[model samples]
Target: MGGEHSPHVPERVPSDDDPADDLPDGLLVADRDGRVVVFNSAARRMTGIAASAALGRDFRDVLPLHDAEGRDWWKCLSPYEGLTIRTRHPERSLFLADGHELLVTAGYRRDAEGRVERFSVCLRDAAHRARQERDRADLVSTVAHELRSPLTSVKGFTATLLAKWTRFNDDQKRVMLETVNADADRVTRLITELLDVSRIEAGRLEMHRQVVDLAGEARKVIAGRVAAGDPEDRFRFEARGELPEMWLDPDKVDQILGNLVENAVRHGAGTVTIVVEPDAHKEGAAVTVRDEGEGIPPEAAQRVFRQFWRGPGGNRRGGTGLGLYIVKGLVEAHGGAITVRRGPEGGAEFRFTVPAGAPDYAS
Candidate 1:
C-alpha cells in the first residue's frame, strides 16, 4: 500500500507565525489524495519524521499506527469511505509500529455534497492518562489494605463469639464485644475518609456556618485524645490573645483540629501543644499545633500536605496519608491557609488561619 506521494505536495518550513506549530499537541493535515500537505513541527517532533520527508508522503506511510489488537488503524478508519455525515473520530489510544503509544483523534473536513475534502489527525502523549490509571490503582490498594485488618478482626471475633457463647465468662465475652465494636468503628471511619476524599476532590465539600468558639474547639480535641487513653498531661492548650466568636463550621473545625492533634501524637512524640489566638490581619482566628519530636524534613515540607504522603515513621505508624490533604482541603474551603515548619522545640509545627465568615455568610 506504500507508494510515492504527489510531486505537487506543497511544503513550507514552520516558523513563529505558523499557528499550527503553536499547538501543544501534534497535528497532521492531509489532502483528499491522502498525501500529507500540512505536517506541523509538533507532528514532526512526535513522529521523528522530518517535514521534508513527510510533506509529500502518504499520511499512513508517514505515521503507521495500530490498535491494541494489532489492526492497522488507518485502514480501520477508512477516512475516505466513512458515512457522509461522520465528521470526527473521538480520541483513542493507538500505537506505532515500534510500540510507542499515542493518543489520537481524527477529523474530516467535507464539502457541500459531504465529500471528503481533507482530514486532520491530532496527537497527544499518553503519559497523563497513564498516571491517572496508576493513581486509581494505588487508591484501590490502599482501601483494600486498610479494610482488610478491621474486617478480619470483626469477622473473627463475631464467629468466635457465636461458636463459643457458653465457653467464655462475662468478662471475656465483654472484651470480645468491645473489640468487635472498635473494629466496626474503624470500618466506618475508613468509609467516611473515602467519602470525604471524593467530596474534597470533586469540589463538593460542604460547610455549615454558625457562631463558634475557636479556643473551645481546641480544648474539645485535647479532651478527646485524653479520653481515648492518651495521658491528660501529655497535651497543653494556650490562648495568646482575647478570643472572639466567629461564624464557622463547628464540625469541620473539630475534624481539622482532631486530624492535626492525632498526627502529632502518631507521627511525632512527647507532649502536644495547641495555641489559639486572634487573627491579626483579619477578624478571624489562627491555631498552631506543635509536638516535641523529629520534625518534617525541610525537603519534604511542600509534599507533606499532598495525598498519600508518609513520614519517616510511615509503616511503623498506621496512616493512609490522606489526613493532611483532607485537612488542607477543609481549611481552604473555609477561606483559610495552612503551613508546616520546625517548631521552637525542633519539632513539627502546623499552623493554620481561618477568616471570619462574612456578616451575611450562610450555608
Candidate 2:
C-alpha cells in the first residue's frame, strides 16, 4: 500500500533498484524532502555525472549550479514551485567543458502539489557549427580589404596618367605610360581574385595544365614590382636548387606571389627577402617572403588569413588587409598551403608551396 498522498503523483516513480527507472534522456526526480529520488542515464550523459551516486543526494550536489558570474546559482531556485529557466546572457555562446562546447537547455519540474521535484538539462555539442560561422565571416572581410587599396590606386593613377600623359617629355611619357599599363594589370588581378575566390568558395576554380618555370616567373614579378617603385636594395630574391619545369596554372601562381610580396611590403619594415626551397613531399617548391618590419601580434596570427580580418590597432599602415587571406586561398587552389610566422629579425614571414613546374606567361 502507498502512503496517503494527493492523486497527482510523478508520471513515473523510479525505485533505487529498477533498471527501467533510468532513462536514456536526461531525467531527474526529487522527493518532497528536497532529496534526489532518481537521476537517470540520460541526465548523466548530458551533465557528465553518474546517476547511482546522485541518488539520495541533494540536487545541488549532482549539478552544482553556477551563476553567469561564477557565483552560486542554486539560491535562485524557488522553494515553493519549479519553473523553467532560460539563459539570460546573450554573449554566453555555449557551455565549455573538458575542451569541448555543448549546446544546452535547462529547466525545472514540479509535483502536483506545486513542490519542486527535478531539474532537467539537455545538451548537444556545437563546435563544428561555431567554427563554420567564424570562417564565413572572415572570408567576407578578407575580400573587402584586398580590393580596397589596389582599386584605389588603379583608379587614381590611371586618371592621373591620362590627365598628365600629354604634358610629359618622351622619357617621362614612357615611364608614365608603363605605370598606367601596370596599374591596369593590377586591377585585372583584383577582379580575377574576386571571381576566383568566389568560385573557390563555390568549388569552381579550375586549373589549366601547362609547364611552368617558377623561377623565371618569380623573377619577372619581382622585376615588375621593383620597377613599380618597391625599393631594389630592400628586396632580395633567391632560388636554392635546379627547379625543373612542371605542370600548373601560371596566373594563379603569380597571384599568390604577388599577394605575399604586397603583404611583406605593407606590413614589414626595412628589407624583404624571398627564399625558395625545394620539397620532396610536395614534388614542388617552398617560397618564403620575410620582412624586417614589426611582426603580427600573437593574438592576431591565426586570424591573419581570415577574410576582411583587419590587423590590430586598426588600418595597418598602408595595408587594406586582404593580402594574406587572398594568398592563402590562391595557394590552396593550387593544391598548396600558406602560413605566416615571426621572421628571424622581428618581422612577419609568409611561406607557401608551389608544384615545381612551368606556367604559361600571359600573352
Candidate 3:
C-alpha cells in the first residue's frame, strides 16, 4: 500500500540550514507544485536574493530567468514535470532581475513513479569566467601572431636566396642572409620565452647557484646591448656603493637584467639608468633599472608582472609580455623581492634585491 501511494511533498519549504545549503555550487530546488523549497547560500549569493525572500514562493514568481533577447524562459521548465528526462545543461546563461548574468547547469530529480519531484539548478557568475576565457584566447592569438611574422620573413628570404643563388651580387646576398639571420634570432628568442613559461608552470625551473658579482653582471648586460647596436648614449650605470657578491643563478640574473634593460630600451625614451648598491636591511644587494620613458600608469602597474599582460595599448613594439613575469619569478626563486614604482626621471623604475653569500652547494 505504501508503494502504491504517490510520494508526499513536505508542507514547509526547506530552510537555509538544509544539507544542500553546504554545497559549493549554487543549488535551487522547486517542488512538483513549482514552489521553491531549497534556496541555498550559494544560490542566494548568485541571484542576489535572500533565502527569506525566495522560500515558499512560486518558482516562476521568485526567479526571473530570461534569455539573451529578454524573453521569459519559464515555459522551458514545464516539459520536465512528467518526462523522465534527467539532464545537465552547462553554461546556460540566465539573466536575473537586476540584469546580472549567471551560468547555470540545471537538472531534474524524478520520483520512482516517473514524475518530476524537484528541479536543481547550480549557478555561478558567468561574467568572470567569460572574461577569463577571453583573456586566455587573446594570449594564444597574440603569441601565434607574434611568431608568424618572423617565420614568414625567414621563409621568404631563405627561399629567395636558395632559388636565385647565382643571380645576386655578394653585397646583396650578404644583406639578405643577414636579414634571415636576424629573423631566426627573433624566432629563437620567442621559442626560448615559451620554453621558460612551460618550465615555470611545471615547477622545473632549476637554478644553478654560484657567487656572482652584482655590479659586474649589470655592466656586462649594458655592454652587450650596446655592442649589439643599442645606442651607447641611451644607457647609464651607477654603483651607489661597493657592491657585494651574491649567491644566485648567474644566468638567471643575466636574464633578469637583460629583460628589464630590453624592456626599457624598447618602451623607454631618452636614457636608461641601472643602479647597484648593497642592501643593508636585507643583508643583500639591490639593483634598480629605470628608464626615462612614459611611466606605467598607476592602475596598470599592478598587472605588469602578470603573464601575458601587455598593458592597455597592446604590444605595439613587438613584445611577448612574458619578460616581466619571468623576471618576477626569477627574483622570487632567488629568495629575493622586486617592486616597480614611478622613477624620479619620469619613467618606470624596477628594483630587486638578492641575498649575499654563497648558496648551499650541498642541497
Candidate 4:
C-alpha cells in the first residue's frame, strides 16, 4: 500500500477545449427513448466496443450493466417508466456482462413538461476512488501514530513539573522544561506538515511572491545551523556563474534549503557543502546540497522524495519522513524540479531548479 497506486484518469469536464472524445472518463449519452447518441472513447475503452458500434443502438444493448446480485440495472431503474421527477442515479459500482466493473452515474435531463429528454451517464474507473480513499486512511493513521509520542511527552513532563514543582532542583526542572519545549516544537511541526500536506493535495497552496535572494537564503540556513551549535568549520558554501533575480516565495526557498541542509547534517556525514549556480538546462537557477558521507543507493534516489520515506539510519534519529516530500512539493509548486544523486565527495547530493524570471501572477 505504500507503493504508488494505479493511474487515476480524472474525467474531463466538458468545455470548449475539452471534447467528449478527449475525456479521460467514460461517458454515454442516450435519448429519452434509450437510443445511444454519444459514446466517448473512454466508454469505448471500458466496454471494448467502438462508439460506432454503440451509437444509435439501445444503450441497454450497449452497456448492459448488472449488479453484484445479477440484477439488471436497466430493469431495476426503468428511467422511461420512472417518476417524471427522477433526476439522477448517484455514482455506484456497476459491472458489465463480462464482469468488468465501472463507476457509473446517470442523470436524467428533463423537458419543461417534467419528462426525461436525455439520459446522460458519467463513467469512471473505481481504482482512482479506491486509491484516494486509501490515501486518506493512511493520512489519518499517520497523524494518530505520529502525534501520540510527542503529545504524551509534552503532557507527562508538564504534568510532572506542575505536581512536583518544589521537589525537583533547578537543573532537573530545566531539563524537564526543555524536553517539554522540544516536544511542543515537534507537535507544532507535525501539525504544520499535516496542514501542508492537506493544502498540497487540495491544490490550495498559496504563493505570495517577491524579489528573493536565493543564495542569501542558503547563507541564512548555514548561519542558522552554526548559531544552533553546529561547527562553522563543518559547512561550506559556493556560488557559481550568474545568479538571476526573479520573483519567488522567499520563505519557501528558505524552507527547502533548511530541510535539505538539516537532513544532510543529521543523516549524512563529514562537511556539508551547498552550491548555487545557473541551471543551463532549465530556465531557473540551481541549488545543490551535498555531504561527504556514504551516498544514497541508485535505486533509492527516486523514493527519497515520497511520503513516509526514511534513510537507512533514519530510525536512530527522529523525523516525520515528510521533510523531503514537502520540499519536493514546495519546489514543484514554484514550477521547479528536484533530484538526488551521488555526490562528487561520495555522499548524497540533492539538486533542485525553480523556474526563474517568470513574473508571479499576483504582480
Model 2 worst lDDT run, 10 consecutive residues = 84-93
lDDT sort, best first: 1, 4, 3, 2
**TM-score winner among the candidates?**
4
Between candidates 1 and 3, the one scoring higher on TM-score is 1
lDDT of 3: 0.81
lDDT of 1 by residue, 202-321 (tens): 999888989888888999999888998999999989999885667889999999999999999998888899999988888888999999999999999999998788876896798778
What are the runs in model 2 whose C-alpha is more than 4 Å off?
A: 1-192, 280-282, 312-319, 356-363
Candidate 4 vs. true structure, TM-score: 0.84
lDDT for each candidate structure? 0.89, 0.65, 0.81, 0.85
What TM-scores do the predictions have?
0.71, 0.51, 0.63, 0.84
> How much is the lDDT of residue 160 in candidate 4?
95
Q: What is the lDDT of residue 109 in candidate 2?
A: 60
Can you give the lDDT of residue 203 in candidate 4? Answer: 82
Please give, for residues 5-115, the per-residue lDDT of candidate 3 as tens digits. Answer: 123655455564688878877877877666677888888878788877877666777677888888876666553543575555556787987789888777776778777
lDDT: which is higher, 3 or 4? Answer: 4
What does the lDDT read for residue 255 in candidate 2?
76
RMSD of 4: 7.1
Estimate candidate 1's alpha-carbon lDDT, on a 0 to 1 scale: 0.89
Question: Which candidate gets the maximum lDDT versus the true structure?
Answer: 1
Pick by lDDT: 1 or 4, better one: 1
Clash pairs, model 1 backbone: none
Tens-place lDDT per residue, model 4, 212-276, is 88888899999999999999999999989886775788888888999999899988999999999
Task: State the lDDT at 269 in candidate 3.
Answer: 77
Worst-scoring 10-residue span by lDDT in model 4: 1-10
